[model samples]
Target: MLPQHADPIVAIATAPGRGAVGIVRVSGKGLAPFVRALIGREPRPREATYGPWRAADGQAIDHGLSLWFPAPHSYTGEDVLELQGHGGPVVLQLLLARCLEVAQTALPGLRLARAGEFTERAFLNDKLDLAQAEAVADLIDASTEAAARSAARSLAGAFSQRVHALRDALIHLRMLVEATLDFPEEEIDFLQKADAEGQLQRLRSALAQLQAEARQGALLRDGLQVVIAGQPNAGKSSLLNALAGAELAIVTPIAGTTRDVVQQTIQIEGVPLHVTDTAGLRDSPEVDEVERIGIERAWQRIHGADAVLFLHDLTRWREPRYRVGDANILRGLPEGVPVLHVWNKVDQAGDELPRGDSDIVLSAKHGTGLDALRQRLLQLAGWQSGSEGLFMARERHLRALARVGEHLEQAQGLLTRAADQLDLLAEELRLAQHALGEITGEFTADDLLGVIFSRFCIGK
Candidate 1:
């Protein structure tokens, strides 16, 4: 059971404001007393009881349906009470307030729910594992259907079980290897004769596959941040409006119309794209205080983007000019992250939409070449067009996986070393196992858990 010895927490589970129904949820030991105080005795488990939730003076606050979930079987592994009533903002607030007052009177130490304390309690009590707890938040905040489904799969332990399976395999190998270490006299010959290297290779292959899948999931969760950069009036802002399907940035024939950076999030075939449009890259006397700040922010965005769409106007695709700016900005963008050499206003340029085989032609105003641009983005993200099997993941998972990769590299080095340091190899293997365990919360710290769940909304 959870720490129901502490006070119960009360919160409105449903969305705030007017609607057909609003639910006020209470969890902990005080649930029964609060329920008894409101509607006489608590109702049957999971059964809807029709009644008027009364105040301390026995006056009806609202006529509603209530359900009681007895201890240990409830969501938080404690007694839970849910009062469903008409969804009026004022009515819901009054209902919540009444429950708090009644709980404080009838049961000592009851208090209002914290931001994500209920879910944290559930996780702490083993009502749900860490992966499932994260899924609760992901499901609530999912902006796309694919994201929601991925989160559901995770909630069902689809992702955790996979990590556990890998951990299990590693444990088996560790047993075999660790046993050899116990008898150092026989280890040299036994390890040399055994297929230890082959086994390590296989483990690495499996880890690589899992790492790839986890990365895909992380992309689905965090999405791609794409920044548009180039000279003045290169259709950078136009591309933003076209992709977002709204006038997110003001476009004009004038060069410096966009003095500040503009951002919009839009889905392209279920892959969320965070597109940013910045002031045209130019030096001008009129570039004032705000515009200068905006330009600095734009540079920051360019530095931290998943992909940079360098909009080189087809009519003016010349050698890299702008002497004051860094030449490496266009020349040495990170290796894997793509920089599309976009030739804009193709219609005006006719059949000659800039030369060279490596350029993409598009007209942001006419909506001519957006599909190809989006496809390029998907490609850079390692996503195949019209592909399936995308999952949802977070940066924490990626960091853990990266640690696994690092350990693998170390293990490989130890294996190939002239001295054949089996101890170092074993230590690397152990490190890799520990890193993998972090993804499923087997080795997570309390503060880390606090940070993760605190990002979630209440009543999750």
Candidate 2:
């Protein structure tokens, strides 16, 4: 905790808007005097008391409900006070000003809270761990219902519980290895009797399973980026519209109808896919300046995409010039990005389909073949259909878990690929446990904690 964190803090807990009701919250070491001065009475603990909030002039500022929570039991593990009144911006601001004015005389060292300060206090007080603290922000910023549910689970400590389980098993293994290392004369017999090799294998298997699920959760939080790219009039915009079920982008027979990047987020099986439609990729002397810029941006988007839908016109499949253009687009595509070959205009192909392996054949105008495309997009995003009970994880969590797995792999190698030198094995186990601690913040740095909580809402 920092020196400034000791001061009493106040803020408008509700959103900045006009609604039926709003809240002005205060948290500090001893807020009873402030609450009594602001509301003309000290409300009972954990109970709402209706009263008229009075100013120093003995006039009513507003009539509202005041709820009090004594220290160590409140959200921030401090004495909490909430004033619920009308939800006008002016009303909230007045209440906030009133708190500051009263604080000058009643509650010393009081000030307005910074962004995420309230939640940071809660974390410092041990009311919630690092993972749950993150889920607080995730829940508020969730873009989809599935994401909200997963965040709720995480806030309730689902992710932390799994990490704790791993930690407990790890502790047991570390204990066995340490006991053996402390007595090297008994190291080999001790390890063989305790079945240390079997324990290591089982722990690694469990870690792999958790890592796989965390990857899926990460996709749910950070949606996949899919780019639609091809030559002019190849139905790129139509495919985007078909996926979105809306006319988001202009569709026409003209080449480069889409002169800019148009993006839409569509959920398939509750997993978000941010699909981008770009201008046609082509080389022609008749290209305009704006069209050339659009083509350059199209390549930029393609290079960044997790998956690229390289749409082709089935009606023009046999032409040598069209094939050359298609080959050019393929050559420009960045390596390692998964490309799905899609042949469009199937309804007008007249049975002369492209004689090659196409991932999908569709008529975007008629809304055909979209279901397969949606499933393929989900696959590319690594989403499993009907997956429930997932944790809302970030890239940092995944990296920590990966490092844990790596250390465990190294530990297994020390046990099998070397002599009975138990010291190195014990160090590997220590590193593995340290990595597991990072996920729940048992071994996190202060700067990392600052970065995590700084992203949260101020009122949290």
Candidate 3:
């Protein structure tokens, strides 16, 4: 824990701008003096008291409800006070300034809270683990309803509970292994008698299940990045508008209307999809400098995309030059990235909507076969239908779980090699336990905490 956690902190807890109400919050050890200084008396604990918040000269600053939460019973495990008043930006600023002024004499060393400092204090005070602290920010920044629900579950300790359970199992297994090492002289094979192999197998199964849920949670949190790339006038902008249900991109009959990347985020069955519509891909010496830059940016986005929706203009599918251009663009795409072939402009081609297991056929202008496209996008994202009880997770959590799995696999391999290599097995188990501990912050560094909490908004 840092020494800064000991100082009293204050901030405008409500968001910026005018609203129905605003809150100025202060948290520290022994806030009773500050409370009396502001409200003229110590308010009842855990109860709201109607009072006039006064300045240093006893002039009324604002009339509001004051709530005082005594130490060990508040959000930060400290004595916390909340002053709720009118939401005007000026009014909130005045209240905040007055609090700081009064604190200069009433409570020395009182300072403004940094971004996410309040939640960080809670973690240092044992109120929340690292994962739960992260989830508080995730919950506030969730873009979709499903994302919000998953973040809420994580904030409620759903993810941390699983990590703790896995860690406990590992501890028990380690105890059994170490005990066997201590009594090697005894015959009867203690490990075999204890069914350590069976225990390890069960642990592996539980880890696999936890990993799958964490992957799903990560998908809900970060969502999929899908980039659209094709030849000019392949209806890329039109497709983006159709998918987003808005004119997020300008569509025109002209081939080069879209000269830059346009982005939109849409949800399919509660799964958020971040779609980027890029400038059409083609080889042309006549192209200007701006179009060339746009095309370069398009390729950059495609390289990073989770999936690329390669659109094909059905009306121009048979042109030899068009075929060459499409083939070249497809070959240039980054390897290992999933590409979904989409045949557009079926209405103009007077073609029946091709049915089968290969590629999506749709007319973005007419909105025909759009449902098929949406489903295909979802399928490409690896989204499982009816995903209930999902918890929000970040990339770091996934990496920690991966490392844990790797350690366990190494232990399993060592166990099969030789009974004399028990030390290696113990080391692997210890590493696995450590990896799991990182997820819940049982093992973590101060630098990591700074990086994690710095992303949160001020006063969180």
Candidate 4:
């Protein structure tokens, strides 16, 4: 533990704004004296007592409730105190100040809690594992119903349970390998009798399934950024509004009406897609300074997007000027980013069809062919429409799982390559175990812990 972890910490537990109620929380060892100084009494443990908060001068500061939790029972496994009162910023500040003032005399080494310090303490105290600790933040930051549900599952140990399952299987396999290496004479027979090859293959199969599910979870947490790009009046804004099912961007027949990016988050099959409608892509002497800036920003966003929806005006596809502008946009799109050729105004295009077989023709004005477009976006994201057992996961989890798979692959090769591979096989298994431990933070570094926790909201 760091020296700072030994000291008591205090902070306003609620958001920094007026609410119906607010909380000022404190946690540390030997917080009894500090509690009595602020509340005038210890009250019952785990119970809320309504009373008046009096100052050192015997003046009433405010009337509210206080709850007490002794060590090994509270959120941080320390003696914790919570002062609940009006949610006004001033009242919360005054209450926070009173705790500090009383701590100066009643308690020593008391200071404000750092962001995520409280939850970090919870993990250190064995109240929650590292995965659950991260889930606490994920649950708060979830933006969609599916994301919130997945995060809630993770907080409930769904992800941790899966990781634990993998770790247990790996440990079992390691034990068998170690036992074989112990008896050099019986090495081959021991492995064969225990079916070591079978275990490795099964483990690899299970890991593949886990990787697919984790990819979905990561996609749920961090959705794809889809940028709508095309010539002016290709109905780029119309496509955005149509996909979002709202008039988020100003749609006018006049070209260059949308002079800025319009972004909106829309969910397809419970997967969030952050769709951005950039200014119409065009380079013309008629373009003004503001439109030029918008066009520049559009390209920047296009380069960063995970996917691009290159919208085309079907009604003017025969025009030489329109075809040239469309060709220019196709050339400008960033390489490696998946591009979906979307043809809008199909209702106005009559029987004329685009040359590309895969081009999606849609009438943004009438909402026709929208279902096909949504399905295509989901396909581009690699989302299985009805995948079961999905949970919230970070990019780090995916990397760790990938590393484990790599080590396992090496171990499997050793099983077949040579009989003298016992020592090498054991080393590979050990590395795989270490990689698995990183997911749940059983083998995490202090600096990584700091980086992870610091992203959390204060007083968490």
Global local distance difference test of model 2: 0.88
TM-score of 2: 0.96
TM-score of 3: 0.97
Cα lDDT, all candidates: 0.78, 0.88, 0.90, 0.90
TM-score of 1: 0.90
TM-score winner between candidates 3 and 4: 3
| Residues 173-274, model 3: lDDT tens digits | 898889878888877776788787888888899999999999889998899999999999999999999999998998888877788999999998878899
Pick the winner on lDDT between candidates 1 and 4.
4
Please give, for residues 345-428, the per-residue lDDT of candidate 1 as tens digits: 887785644445766788898999888888888887776555466556788887888898898778777776614477777888
Q: Residue-wise lDDT of candidate 2 within 1-460, one digit each (tens)?
A: 7898899999998887899999999999988888887887787899989978776787777788999999899999999998899998988888889999999989988998888888888888989888888889888988888988898998999999989999899899889888876776753667778888999899998899899888888888898999999999999999999999899999989777789999999888778889999999999997899999999999999999999999999988899999999999999889999999999998988876764564798899998888888887888787889898998999999999999999998998899843465788889999999999998888999899889987876677
**Per-model TM-score on C-alpha atoms:** 0.90, 0.96, 0.97, 0.96
Steric clashes per prediction:
1, 0, 0, 0
Off by over 4 Å in 3: 350-356
Q: Any runs in candidate 4 off by more than 4 Å, and if so which?
A: 355-357
CA error at residue 158 for candidate 1, angstroms: 1.1
For candidate 1, what is the lDDT?
0.78
Which regions of candidate 1 are displaced past 4 Å?
1-6, 183-195, 286-290, 318-337, 350-356, 412-422
